[model samples]
Every structure is written in structure tokens, then in C-alpha cells.
Target: MSTLSGKTALITGSVQGIGLAVAKVLAGAGARIAVHGLADAQQAEAAVSAVRSAGAPDARFFDADVRDVAKIEAMMAEVAEWGGADILVNNAGIQKTASLADADAATWDAILAVNLSAAFHTMRLGLPAMAERGFGRVINIASVHGLVGSINKAPYVASKFGLVGMSKVAALEYASAGTRETGGVTVNCIAPGWTETAIIEAQVQARAEQFGGDTEKGIADLLAEKQPSRRTSAPEEIGELALWLCHRHAHNVTGATIPVDGGWTAQ
Candidate 1:
């Protein structure tokens, strides 16, 4: 039998990138998927279809901005029709590259709202249902910045660090219970290093423009400087780790900020 067979997973911001990768991985393991996106119904539907194609028996789309608490609550109600959530992946986040001195209030607020507050909103609404069911998995897609600082990314780092802290507390609060006995949940965060996503590509391009060099060279330089492997990570790697964490054996691994970085945090 599949590891997550019969479980229902709600993955926020799963229309693309790492979020989509996680959805595909979980669905491949035989879980029902709730593919979420901000507003693009068509994209959300496509995500649902992709999950269904990946061996999920059931898949649905949830359209709601993660930054909005009320909308998240409403989406949870809609998701309740699918028998509530057994897995919750908080992957909705935004980033802006600006040093503290250059960072504006608007940019900081936007980063915090989407990257940190959104996760909190989802957890607040989803936790009770998880606690009631006595079984749940909450995975937050954090960043290596959560453990280490990065240049021109103050807000992103702050929000991710906060997420890591929050995840640990939530994990401890629920760790004393178990699914077989009380349906208790495990909460963990995955902190990815330099990933080859659209966001990273944009950063590469921006760096290239700033230095008057090729984007490929800029990207390589970034890897050489920050990542010990001197290579960018594929989205599937994060997806695989997330899948592993959802298995029954991973129950004891909660409250941990697992780094999937290329030894970025190790250095």
C-alpha cells in the first residue's frame, strides 16, 4: 500500500515551483490532493489534474490568497467537504531582495504577510481539525535563510526564521500525542538552499544585469559562493524529502528545521 494512501493533503501555493513539486510527490504516494493557488482558477485546476495524474484518487482546487486569514478559513471550510485535511503544506511565500537600509516598509510587510503570516493563518485554521482528527502533517517550505543570513534579503530571512521557530513550537505542542491513540500531528519545516526556480532565475538575471555578465555565469557564481556543492537543487529533491517526512516512520521527526541545502547551512 502507498505510504499516504487514504490521506487528504492540502498544499497551498501549489500551482507552480516547489509547491507543485510537493503536490506531485504526495499524490504519487496515493494521497488525495487539494491544490491551492491565489486566484488563477485555471492554473489551480491544472494543478489538481496533475495531482490526479500522479496516482491521487481524488484532487480538487482551492483558490484563496494565503495572506488573507478570512479566505483561508473559508477555504478550509470548502476543504472540509473532502473530509478535512490530513496533510497541510504551507508553501505560499514571497521574497524581495533589499538590504535593511534599502528595504521599504511596504516590501517588508508584503514579505511578512505572504511568507510568515500566511503560514500562521493556515495553521490556525487547520490545526484544530488536525488535533481533532488526531492525525496530520504540517510541512512549511522554509529557506536556508532561516538558519543563515543572506545579503539583500532581510525580510525574507526574518520571516523564514520566524516560521522555523513557530514550527518547532507547534511540533512540541502536538508531539506528545500519536495518530493511533489521539491522531496527533507532526509539524516540520524544510529549508531549501539555492533552488533552480523562477525566483532564483530572476535573481540570477538581476545579478547578471548588475554585474554586466551572463546570467548563467552569475548563477554559477552564486552556487560557488553560497552552496558547498556549487550546484543548484532541483525542485524534485525537496519534493522527495517532503514525501519521506509524511510517512508513518517520520512521526518522531517533528519540530525540526531540516535543511535540504547543498551544505549551505553546514558552512
Candidate 2:
């Protein structure tokens, strides 16, 4: 039997990147999927289609901007109608690489809204349902920035660091409360190193323009300098780790932060 044969998973920011990869992995394990996107209905539908094609018993699109608390609450209500969320992947986040001196109020607010506050909104609304059902898996897609520091990414680092702390507290709250009628829940965070997603593509292109180098070479230099493998991580690597965390064997592993970076954090 599949590890998640009868489960339902909600993955935010699932239209692309790490979120999409995680959705596909969970679907492969036989979970029904609720794919979420910010405001693009078509993208959301396409994500659902991808999950279904990957062997999900069923998949549906949800339109909600994670930064909007009202929208998040409404989306969770809709998801509950479909039988509540068994797995929640808080992967919706935005990043900016500005020094604190250059960071403005608006920039800080925007980054916090999407990266930190969004996770709070989702967890606040989704946790009650999870507690009621007594079974749930919460995976927050954090970054190595959460554990360490990075240059020109103050807001991103701050938001991610806060998320890791929140995940640990949530895990402790729900870990020892399982009953026969209620299933157990596990909450964890995954900190990925630089992955070659659309976000990184944009970063690479920007760096290339700034340094007068080919984008490919710029990307390679960026990876070689920081990542021990001399390569950036793949989104699917994070997906597989997330899949493992949700399995039965992972029951005792809550409040932990797993890094999928190719030894970037090691240095």
C-alpha cells in the first residue's frame, strides 16, 4: 500500500519550483492533492493536472494569496469541505537580495507578508482542523538562510529564521497529544540550498548582467563558490526528503530542520 493512499495534501505556491516538486512526490505516494497558486487560475489548474498525471487519486486547484489572511482562511474552509488537509506544505515565499541599508519599509513589509506571515496564516487556520482530526503533517520549505546568514538577503534570512522557530514550537505542541481516536501529527522544516528554480534563474540572469558574464557561467560560479558539490540542488531532491518526512517511520522526527543543500551549510 502507498504511504499516503488515503491522505490529502495541500501545497501552497505549488504552481512551480519546490512546491510543485513536493506536490508531485506526495501524489506519487497516492495522496489527493490541493494545488495552490497566488492568483493564476490557469497555473493552479495546470498544477492539479500535473499531480493527477503523477498518480494522485484526485487533485484540485485552489486560488488564494498566502499573504492575505482572509483569503487563506477561506481557502482552508473550502479545503475542509473536501475533507480537510492531512498534509500542509507552507512553501509560498518571495525573496529579495537587498542590503539592510537599501531595504525600505515597503520592501520589508512585502517580504515579511509573503515569507513569514503567510506561513502563520496557513498554520493558524489549518492547525485546528489538523488537531481535530488528530493527524497531520506540516512541512515548511525554509532555507539555509534560516540557520545561517547570507549577504544582501536580510529580509529573507529573517523571515526564514522565524519560520524555523515557529515550526519547532508547533511540533512540540502537537507531538505528544495523540489518542486512539486521534492520529498523531508531525511538523518539520526543510532548508534547501540554492536550487535551480525560476527564482534562481532570475538571480543568475541578474548577476550575469551585473558582472558582464554569460548567465550559465555566472550560475556555475555562484554554485561552485558556495556549494560543496559545485552544483546547486535539484527541486526533486527536496521533494524526496519531504516525502520521507511524511512517512510512518518519520513519526519521531518532529521539530527538526533538514537541509537538502549539497553541503552549502556545512561550510
| TM-score of model number 1 | 0.94
Q: Report lDDT per candidate.
A: 0.86, 0.86
lDDT of 1 by residue, 31-110 (tens): 99998887566776788888888888898888887767788889988988778888999998888797889999999989
lDDT digits (tens) for residues 75-97 of candidate 2:
99999999889899999888878
lDDT of 2 at 236: 80
- Cα RMSDs of all predictions? 1.7, 1.8
Q: Score residue 29 of candidate 2 by CA lDDT.
A: 93
